[model samples]
Target: MGFRLPGTRRASFATKVASSKSCEVPKGYLAVYVGEKMKRFVIPISYLNQSSFQELLSQVEEEYGYDHPMGALTIPCREDVFLNVTSSFNRC
Candidate 1:
């Protein structure tokens, strides 16, 4: 089954945060699309508190301004860079 990334249909973040496994976000994590193809990654919620990760969120906010077609938080960055940041978070 394809992982269901949030889309632009509506503001689902609040709903996703409240629901359980059936909501596609799993638990304590979120799905984001990275790279040109919009690749998807389900990342831990703790990553939100990291400065490096927050940088990416800022970029997303700047570009999308809470509205885009991808349904998921889109990170406009090289896959390697995204992976490197996330890998460090995994280590912590």
Candidate 2:
């Protein structure tokens, strides 16, 4: 899966950086930055409806409010924790 945020595009070192081929999220996917390094992850939009995921969203709201420094949804958690939580979705 590809990872990127809207509006604030990071520079790519790849040779083919087309202006038209920007980071556009697929219809049912959402992009979020996680951890202090702000690593980006693209996940299914359906995850938002899950109780476990909603709890994480709550933490994000409490910490960042609407002012996300990354210009996209940011989840304030360790990368491993976020991965563990999201990986569980595969079982459901």
lDDT per model vs. reference:
0.65, 0.66
Best by lDDT: 2
**TM-score winner among the candidates?**
2
Worst 10 residues of 2 by lDDT: 11-20
Candidate 1 segments whose C-alpha is farther than 4 A from its true place? 1-23
TM-scores of the models, in the order given: 0.65, 0.71
Per-residue lDDT of 1-92 in model 2, one digit per residue for the tens? Answer: 22223333332321122222457766777677788988766666888897989998888788778788878788879887886777566552
Cα lDDT for residue 23, model 1? 34
List the lowest-lDDT window of 10 residues for candidate 1: 1-10
Please give the RMSD of candidate 1 to the true structure.
9.9
lDDT tens digits, residue span 1-92, model 1: 12222342332443343333443776778777778877667766778998989988898798768775777677878777887776665342
